[model samples]
Target: MSDNRRIAEEIIKAVGGKENISSIAHCATRLRIMVEDKENINQPAIEEIDKVKGAFYNSGQYQVILGTGTVNRIYEEVEKLGIEGMSKSDQSKEAAKNGNLLQRSIRSLGDVFVPIIPVLVATGLFMGLRGLVMQEQILALFGLTLADISDNFILFTQILTDTAFIFLPALVAWSAFRVFGGTPIIGLVLGLMLVSPSLPNAWGAAVGDVEPINFFGFIPVVGYQGSVLPAFIAGIIGAKLERQIRKRVPEALDLIVTPFLTLLVMSFLSLFIIGPLFKSVEEYILQGTLFVLGLPLGLGGLLIGFFHQIIVITGVHQIFNLLEIQLLDKFGNNPFNAIITAAIAAQGGAALAVGVKTKSKKLKALALPSSLSAFLGITEPAIFGVNLRYGKPFLMGLIGGAVGGFTASLLGLKATGMAITVIPGTLLYLNGQILPYLLVNMIAIGVAFTLTWLFGYSDKEKKM
Candidate 1:
């Protein structure tokens, strides 16, 4: 039998047979199954299957991390076994019903922000590329000075790097509205109002280049260009209000009246109350994060790096999106990126050690690919399929993260962007940061690999 077919059959048996599954679906990298009873499934057996990266119960679904192409193929094989497959939307609804308040909240935040990360990643790459060409050293190599650069070309580069952040509220608001079941277009309009040209820009107002417009003599308002919390709050409020208004208005008037009242009332409340209040709250959050990251001797990085993947396992790592947004919004440099990349790289290193030391060809196959995925900044496979399963490698990976994080902090490493980390993350460290970025990753991977090879893996424990 083909590997995927055999793996699929093994999975059904491991999860307590096909009778225990309520529904199944596949995302980009996982097979999400809603089981009839969690207690019935053997998670260890599932994780031990060849090509199965990891298995865990999350939200309301038992997710098997099977990598990208493998998941689609395995899922197809699963379908051939007579188990029904659900749509992604249906799967989301099923999973949504399972998490507690905190899980749901974090998941909602993740849902809202995750869609927007690609834009930011692309923008960061653009920023790095722009910075690269603008450097005096790079320009000197071309025998051209900064003044020789065309103003039009410079303006175009600014458009690429600045557009996403300049309209970030719109993206956040739109995403939030979609997640909260509101009209996304209305949310987009609302977000645009927050950054309207009539108001003084937030950056300009902060630097005192322009004064904020005051309402009722005390309430001050400015354009929210690089804001997060306010936009998200506005989206939720707007969506809720729209839903409430829709229920009250007559069908004939609903089309016109619902949007009108939603916009009118929400605009005032958002600008006067929500925007101002949450902006301060966001600032406080930003300050608190800075305090943690700024701890003496990189202790902050050490702590976060060590615990980062642990947080990922608990499924609350989405909350870090807020901190990262705050960092990018305030300082334009994200130290968190550097620290987390080290943490992620260490997992890959540890997994690689397992691949090297194991005599079992089945394990070698799983370990090598899983390690590659971790290096690309996706760590579920490495963490679940290899390191965590082996016990000692997971701890070794954490220690590697701590040491690498300290080096990053001591050397003052930061990235031009967020989201992308490890290898593709190199884009964020361009311009002048290439060497230190490489050094930090190498050290992290090196430490984890050495430690795991020496102490984490054992051929005696290999079952295959």
Candidate 2:
């Protein structure tokens, strides 16, 4: 048998045979495998493979890491085994059953961005703390005034945050290409054009006051920067194009000619067809959100506020970026800022509940600091370990979040900037109605705390 076929068979056997795998996909450096029985797969044997780095499971996916370029090749080989229709629980029927609403929501959240969240959170926290330091003149001892420090910090933070968005096309291209078993460099080049700063400026200026840019005598092309879906579509197209090009190009000129043709065609399609189509959809979604938020503050705020924690738990809360970005760009402020404050408060409430209810000193120690961290908008530890474990605390937090959100909306509180660290940052929103916002926040926390205490602990029941 051929070497590629042999490799595929080896992988199939290592993963508990072709019967054990339900489905498979690949990421930048890992094979995302869905197995019928996770226990059936021999992780150590898989890791021992020359191309494999390690293996682990998260978000209901069995992941096998393979250094750099191996993922694409392995993914391609696996696809030929005709295992595409296998269910995630085909091997172990019990595994495929759905979890509860909260469990499913949390799992979905982790699945969507768990691979990318560490960098996103770290970058966010860095920006928030950096702003505080500059605002407080904490770096003045280094001969830097507040203005100077702020400028420098803002520049650095912008670069870091923007990198992910700006080069998002490239990241998606690389990941998708590897997943589909194609040359990533060709996909990367195609992605680069979509995010190219010069292209957006040029396109924007060209279409100024007339209409959006048109491509190839008919198709409309939109400028893509900091967009998610368009780049993903483009990457998929680019990978397919690369596969075709590789087959047709001569061995001697394949390196140079294949990439050139793939990039040229993919870039054209991305800019002219894919990018503009997605942009229009994004604009429509934003308009829909505005209409929804325009409802009466009591119902609108309560619903939005109540579901906000649920959204965060699902990790699709980043969808809120559309509202925040639009408001920031047009109005220089956003009212949705109060929603985030409530989210932080909910985590704090839940953590406090866990701390008070748990009898184990070790658990209390962990919960205490976790509560403080949640108060500062760092809620993973509390959410994953405490609130989730104790269940009632999380529900109480949502109730608190809804009440707080409603009060803030009623007061028409607006945030001047996006700051994860809330207590001190709340001052930034203190234009005229400072007291109302403060009162709203305090009330929200109080409600959350009371609910947590009541639901999380029973006077008649012994503490754990």
Candidate 3:
């Protein structure tokens, strides 16, 4: 057998063979398998597998950290072994179907956000690049001003950069439909209707540069171009409405009538009711977040730093994603981005210390790569696979993050972008403010490292 098959077989055996697995899924860096019994898992054996970095249980899955670019192959091998695989959405749906209300809500929330993270990551990179190209020094090196750039090229870059936020409703609607067990194409059409070019753009509306159109000559209406909550609520309405329609419509005419009715009904309700209601809610949330973060003496950063990773562990950190975007939209910068960066770096620091302090080859292999990944802005491997697996290291990382966050908050460190952190995060600070950003991160890393090295691990916990 090829190596991947062998590894897949070994994984199955270690997790109590094929019989014990209830379902399987994979994300960017881990194999998330649900098992019938945790007691049947051979943790030591799984840890010994070549190329398997580490294993841990979280969010009800037996997750094996496989690093970026490597997880897909293992997931495929596992699939070929005749075990059915599920999408993250499907997995969330199955697990949350019978869960408590809170569990279902959290799963639904994750469904709306996790699938879109890659786009946000790309947006963060663009923000970084935009900062670099527009800097006075960088422009001087190129013998140009911000205005010296060609207007057509500038518009092209603007389109490329803002398209995601411009029609963000469409993406959310599409994902949310699938999550809620409805036809996704209908969701796509509804999303497009919400952000049609005929309507005023969200940014223009925000700046009062465009007037709202009166719907049916009475209620005011505007496009939901950059709105999340509106699209999310609309998706729920559309999905439920479509499901109900599908039940009554004949299959012969189902394809023809169902989508038409779903879109026609949702568009009117969204433009007049749900969209307006949710937009107001989002505004209140934005104001509340701003007030909290603007508190004196860095309290916001300190608390967020100490607990952000815990939020990540529970998969609810995406709510802050909405806050970050709103902060960037209403203001010009995101202070929360830098604070979150410190939080992630602390986890990396703790993991690095664990790697250095460990005697076992398995723990060494797990911690080192995970720490490196954390520095690059992906912390699941380090957080779930390492620091969180050993509870003390997780707490130590939190302390380090709290200190770093407090420092950044006190210094009023801000980023030109959102959603990227750690190494790639440096890109967000390239505009004449690189030094202080670097200093803030360094302090965070140093504190976390010192604390982790001092208290996060011991030889006794190194058995893998």
Best by TM-score: 1
Clashes of each: 0, 3, 0
Better of 1 and 2 by TM-score: 1
Candidate 1 wrongly placed segments (more than 4 Å)? 1-13, 16-19, 76-90, 461-464
TM-score of 3: 0.92
Model 3, 353-387: lDDT tens digits are 99988887778887898889999888888887788
Candidate 2 lDDT, 135-161, residue by residue in tens: 434566676675564566578867864
Measured against the true structure, the TM-scores of the candidates, in listed sequence, are 0.94, 0.60, 0.92
CA lDDT scores, all candidates in order: 0.90, 0.63, 0.84
Tell me the spans in candidate 2 whose CA falls farther than 4 Å from its real position: 1-188, 195-211, 243-253, 312-337, 357-363, 411-441, 459-463
Q: Is candidate 1 or candidate 3 better by TM-score?
A: 1
Position 226, candidate 1: lDDT: 95
Candidate 3's C-alpha lDDT? 0.84
C-alpha lDDT of residue 421 in model 1: 92
